[model samples]
Target: MPRRTLPTAEDQAARFVRQREADRKATAEDYVELIADLLREEGEARAVDLARRMGVSQATVTATVGRLQRDGLVETKPYRGLFLTAAGTALAAEAKARHDLVVRFLIAVGLDAGTAEQDAEGIEHHASDKALTAFARFLSERGDTT
Candidate 1:
C-alpha cells in the first residue's frame, strides 16, 4: 500500500509535523497489550522481564508502566512484579486478539513462525480494527489453520 501523504494545513505545518511524529510513536494500547500479555503468561513480570522480552531496556518498560498505571491498566509495586488491572486485562485481550490475527495472516501468506511473529508485532500495532476484523473473517473462512 502506498503511504498516504499527510494533508497539509495553512500555517499548521508545525502541528502537522507534531501529529506525524506522534503517529510514528508507539501507541499506549500497544504497550498495554504487550505488558498485559506478558503478565498473563507469566502471572506477573518485573519491568526487566518485559524489557528483555521486547529487547528494550528496563527503563523503557518502567516508563510505559507509569503510563499504563496512569491509564488504569496496571498496578505495580516497588519490590514486586507488575500485574494488569481489570482495564488492563481488557486491553490486553484486545492486543492478544490483534496479535493472533496478524500471526495467522502472516502464516497464511507463507511466512515462517519466527518471521511471522516479528511481522505480526508491527502489523498488529499498525492495522485498523476494520482491517483486523476483515482479516479475522478471512482467516475464519479459510479455517484459520497454519
Candidate 2:
C-alpha cells in the first residue's frame, strides 16, 4: 500500500472553491425537488411550508425562493403557492435520478439500506455524471437495481 501526501495550500483552496460551487448547485436542486414533492403531496408549496420542511427560517426560504425565481426555476404568485417552471421541474427530475443512482451504488457496495440512504444524500451532490453513469453500469452488470 502507498501513503499519500497532504494537500497543498493551493490545492485546498481550489478544492474548497469547487466544493462551494457544487454545494450551491445542490441547494438549488434540493429546493426545486422539495417544491415539486410538496406540490405533489400537499397541492401547494408555500414559503412557510417550505421553511417547515427544510427546518430553516422563513427569511431564508424567502431569500432562496427569490433566487430561484430569478434563476427561472420557480414562479410565485401573490397569495398563491410556489410553482415550478419547466426548467425547475426538469432539474428536479435530474436530481432525483442522480440520487437514486447514488443510493443504488452504495447499496451494491454492501452498505445497509439506512446508511446508503444517508450517505447518498451527500454523494449525489458531489458525484459527477460520469461517476454516476459508471455506478449505474456496475449495478446493471450485477443485474441488481435495488
Candidate 3:
C-alpha cells in the first residue's frame, strides 16, 4: 500500500474554513427548524422561547436573529413574533430530514436511543451528502423505517 502524504498547511487551513462555514450554516438551520416547531406547537416563536430552547441569552438570540434577518432567512413583525421566510422554510425542511436520517442510522447501528439522539444533533449538520446517502441505503436494506 502506498503511504499517503500529509496535508499541507494550506490544505488544513482550507479544511478549517469549510468546517467553519458548515457550522455557521448548521446554526442557521437549527434556528429555523426550532422556529418552525415553535410555530406549529405554540402558534408563534418569540425571542424568549428561542433563547430558552437554545440555552442562550436573549442578547445572543437577538444578535443571531438579526443576522438571520439580514440574510433574508427570517423576518420580524415589530410586536409580532419572528417568522421564517420561504427560503428559511426550505432550509429548515432539509435540515430536519438530515437530522432524522442521522438519528435513525445511529439507532440502527445499535447505539442507545438517547445517545443516538444527542449524537445525531451534531453529526446531522456535518455529515456529507455521500455519507447520508449511504446511511439511508443501509437503513433501507435492513427493512427499517422508524
Note the Cα lDDT for every prediction shown. 0.76, 0.92, 0.93
Q: lDDT (0-100) at residue 84 of candidate 2?
A: 99
Q: Which candidate number maximizes lDDT?
A: 3
* Model 1, position 115: C-alpha lDDT score: 98
The all-Cα superposition gives candidate 3 an RMSD in Å to the true structure of: 2.1
Give each model a TM-score.
0.74, 0.88, 0.91
Give the alpha carbon lDDT tens digit for every residue of 1-146 in model 3. Answer: 99999899999998888789889998899999999999989999999999999999999999999999999999999889999999989998999999999999999999998999899989998888899999999999999776
**1 versus 2: better TM-score goes to:** 2
User: In model 3, which range of ten residues has the least summed lDDT?
Assistant: 13-22
Candidate 2: where are CA atoms >4 Å away? 6-14
| Total clashing pairs for each candidate | 0, 0, 0
Instruction: Supply the global lDDT for candidate 1.
Output: 0.76
Using TM-score as the measure, the top candidate is 3
Encode model 1's per-residue lDDT on 59-126: one tens digit a residue. Answer: 88778788878878889877888877888778778777778889988888799989999888777766
Task: Give model 2's TM-score versus the native structure.
Answer: 0.88
